[model samples]
Target: MALRRLSTLLALTFALGAVAGAVGARTAPRMWADQLVNVTTDDLRWAKTRVRVNVDHWDPGAQTGLHRHPGPTVIYVLDGEVEEVFPDGKTVRLRAGQGVWNPARTSHNVRNVTSEPARVLAVHLDPG
Candidate 1:
């Protein structure tokens, strides 16, 4: 039964290792929803001035009400088509795999003008 005991120990070790890895990955420095709404920021290497992470989702016909950024921001299209509306009412269409970079303090809005829903990974610079 020593072999059985060793097998059990190995299994336990593997399980512990998996749990540790998962916890480490979750706690690792990454974006969370709190940063966007509350403006709670942590280490922002991307936004050397001020880093903010805002993962946005949009339904068909949905739009991101008027907003502005302090620094150039990145909008990575996740799916479907989106129109980035500028203050002048001009719009830039971004399809899947496309991206848009807005300069500091650029006013704009995001809308899913298509029938399909879309998602975007918006990374706005805090410029701290």
Candidate 2:
């Protein structure tokens, strides 16, 4: 029940942010985040994974340096527009409220394309 409530809250927050971006509202330029979960201690006999949520405010004309993820990642575009670029020059554009799923071991880069900063929430689940 607690998890349900948290999920509902996140959904509402994302919805409002998306609507604000679509309307070009002033509220669309920033990012808001929830705390990280998966605080289990690591055990040698098993694999424990950590979960983290990252809210990013990507400045205009800004791009993320190349990075790697050893785990699966899920990201939501809360406001404005951003592009996820691959090493081969492929790009996936995310608009307000769009969600993306990245497989484990994926490597990529990102850039914000709009005049205003882009807001995004990244949920990462560590690999076993």
Deviating ranges (above 4 Å) for candidate 2? 1-47
lDDT of 2 by residue, 1-128 (tens): 64675466446545544554445433323322222122122322233555555566676777766886888777788777889988888899999768888988788887787787776766665755
Which model scores highest in TM-score? 2
- Report the lDDT tens digits of candidate 1 across residue range 1-128: 64575356435533443343334232111232321222123443432445455445566777757888777777777567889998887989999768877878889987778987665656655666
| Candidate 2 accuracy as TM-score | 0.64
* Superposition error at 64 for model 2 (Å): 1.1
Best by lDDT: 2
lDDT computed for candidate 1: 0.60
lDDT values, one for every candidate? 0.60, 0.64
